[model samples]
Target: MRRRARELAMRALFAHTQGGVDLEEALRHALEEMGGEDDPYGDPLDEEGVAFARRLLFGYKAHQEEVDRVLKETVEGWDFGQMSKTDLTVLRLAAYEMLHEPTPFAPLIEVAVKIAKRYGGEHSGAFVNGVLGRLFRRIQEGEVKAAPKED
Candidate 1:
């Protein structure tokens, strides 16, 4: 159920990125498309899951410039523009979750890796893992600074 929610969120993000839809609007639209209020399992699209997705989308949207800057700095010679839309979306979502939110890292990274493997090409999982691993190390090493300056 949680996995399905993430996949739905990713799909919505991809559609938004590819189609230029507003993020919240896109999410609401995604909720609708995914059966919206009728979300049989309870909690109206699983409040926790949809909220998680919304949090991811908002964080990524808010910090996209910084995120892209990090990606540019980290991925040598690989222009962000050159990345596949799906790969880029996955990377952004994973990086945001891993770096910004209070969620545990390993499982989120694992989800991203698995999603990449399932949705992207042969090299996508390795590619996402390598990039996310770099991001994780940067955070652990105090290289990638957090917002609001955690004490």
Candidate 2:
């Protein structure tokens, strides 16, 4: 159920991002359409899972510029415009989490790859993994701090 919530969040993000609608409204609309507590994809996520998705969305919105900067800085050759929106949204969300959340890199990376494979281009899983893995290593080596210290 949590997974489904993540996927749903991803889907909504893809919609807002690619469609260029207001992201928050688009996400809310998408979640509403995804069906209720008995959603067929799985048991509707519990409140915790739903809340997590919202938290992720808010975080993504709050720090998207920084996340995109990190992606542009970390990815060697690929430009943001050259990437698929699915891949971009997935990376943006993961990048925000990497910077702000205490979630471990391994599971976070796994989830990002899963999201990419499920929603992005065929190469998105590997692409996201490669980029995010490098960032994770930099963080581990103390070469980078999440988003600089918050004031």
Candidate 3:
């Protein structure tokens, strides 16, 4: 369920950032593309999955500046313009979860890498893993502080 939610959230973020769609519209389109409840050919998300996806979407939006900043700082050589949209979206979602969610960093990074591999370019998984590993180490070393959880 969490994986599905992450996938949905990534797609929505990608649409919003790359396709220039608004957040709600991007989410609605992602849900429909991923197989809405009414789509017989698609794998529909459960209620919990949808809810979690919404949390990620809104949470990321709420902290988009910090997330992007962290990503920019952590990425060694690549500029945001040079990064693939899919990879950037996965990183943004992962960074948001890392900052706000209670989930451990390993699982979050693992999920992000998996999603990157599925949706990104050939080297995306390694790229995401490298960047996220650096980010996690920075967090652990007190170079980055996790934000307070929002209500």
Candidate 4:
């Protein structure tokens, strides 16, 4: 159920981002569509899981410039500007979790790959996996901070 909600959120975010709508407004719209004051998932998600997705969404929005810079720099020869809006947004969201969230790298990477496969290009899973694998290693090695201080 939570996964479904996440997918919905991702899809909405992707649409808004690609269409150049305001991100915070888009998120607020997502929250409202999902039942602003209600438990929209039906099943109760653990606080950790709910928080994980929310943090990923907020962090992605908050640090979009930096995130895109990393994407631009790390993708080497891959033009993110030319990618599908859906693919780019999914990549950004998963990259946010992979780099910024307090979860383990492996699980985050796996989830990202799955999302790419489910919603992106035929080879998007591998593409996302490769990018995130290298990025995760850099973070683990202290070459980069997953994200700036979450203040």
Candidate 5:
């Protein structure tokens, strides 16, 4: 269920990136296309799942500039624009969750790599793993700081 939510959020982000729609609108449209409030377990519009997706989308968008900066600094020798859209989305999603969502480092990084392999191109899994591993290393080394926990 959680994985479904993440995938949905990524799809919405991809839609926003590729379709040029506002992020909220893109998420709405994606859920609607997935069957709205009706079909739950049978469709992608899982109730709890959408809530998690909404959280991810909002968090990702709210800190997009900083997140992009982090990605820019983390990934060496690759222009952000040069990234494949799928890979970029995966990285952004993973990066945001890694920093904010309180999921553990190993599971988070592994999940991101799996998603990249599922949705991204040939090298995306390895690429995402490398980039995320770098970020995790920084976190371990106290170079990349996490925001203070609230409540």
Candidate 6:
């Protein structure tokens, strides 16, 4: 359920950032598409899953500036413009969760890697894993602080 929520949040983030869609609209569309008849593997999120997805989406939006800043500083070699959108979106979602959610870092990173591998370029899983691993270390070392919880 959490993994599905993360995937939906990533898709909604991509739609909002890259496609210039309104955030709420993007989320609604993502939810609809996920449950739409065309998606063979689509299992619509349960209510709890939907709430989690909303938390991720709004939480990320609430802290996008800080999230992007952290990502810009943490990512090695590739600039934001050079990274795959899917990979970047996955990173952003994971980063946001790292900064706010109480979930353990290992599973968060694992889920992000899986999502990247499923929806991203050839090396996206590795790229996301490496970057997120570094970010997690920074958090552990107190270089990054968790953002205040959103209302």
Instruction: Give the best candidate by lDDT.
Output: 6
Better of 4 and 6 by TM-score: 6
How far in Å is the alpha carbon of 47 misplaced in model 1?
1.8
The model with the greater TM-score, 1 or 2, is: 2
- For model 5, what is the error of residue 38's alpha carbon versus the real structure, in angstroms, after optimal superposition? 18
Candidate No. with top TM-score: 6
lDDT of each: 0.76, 0.79, 0.89, 0.68, 0.84, 0.92
Better lDDT candidate (3, 6): 6
lDDT tens digits by residue: candidate 2, 11-69: 77878888887877877777776766655654566678778888888888888887788
Backbone clashes, each candidate: 0, 0, 0, 0, 0, 0
- Candidate 4 local lDDT, 28-69, one digit each (tens): 565555533453444544556456556677788887888887
What ranges in model 1 sit over 4 Å off?
33-44, 146-151
lDDT score for candidate 5 against the true structure: 0.84
Give the per-residue lDDT digits (tens) of candidate 6, residues 67-99.
Answer: 999999999898999999999999999999999
Which ten residues in a row are the worst by lDDT in model 2?
142-151
lDDT of 3: 0.89
The deviation in Å at residue 65 for candidate 5 is 1.0
- Which 10 consecutive residues of model 1 have the lowest summed lDDT? 35-44
The candidate 5 region of ten consecutive residues with least summed lDDT is 35-44
Model 5 clash pairs? none
Q: Write the per-residue lDDT of candidate 5 for residues 1-151, one digit (tens) a residue.
A: 7776777788799999888989989998777755456445345556788998999999998989988899999998898789999999989998898788777777778878887998899999999999999998888899888644334
List runs of model 4 lying over 4 Å from the truth.
28-52, 147-151
Question: Which regions of candidate 5 are displaced past 4 Å?
Answer: 32-45, 147-151
Model 2 misplaced regions, further than 4 Å: 35-40, 147-151
**The CA-based lDDT of model 1 is what?**
0.76
Ranking by lDDT: 6, 3, 5, 2, 1, 4
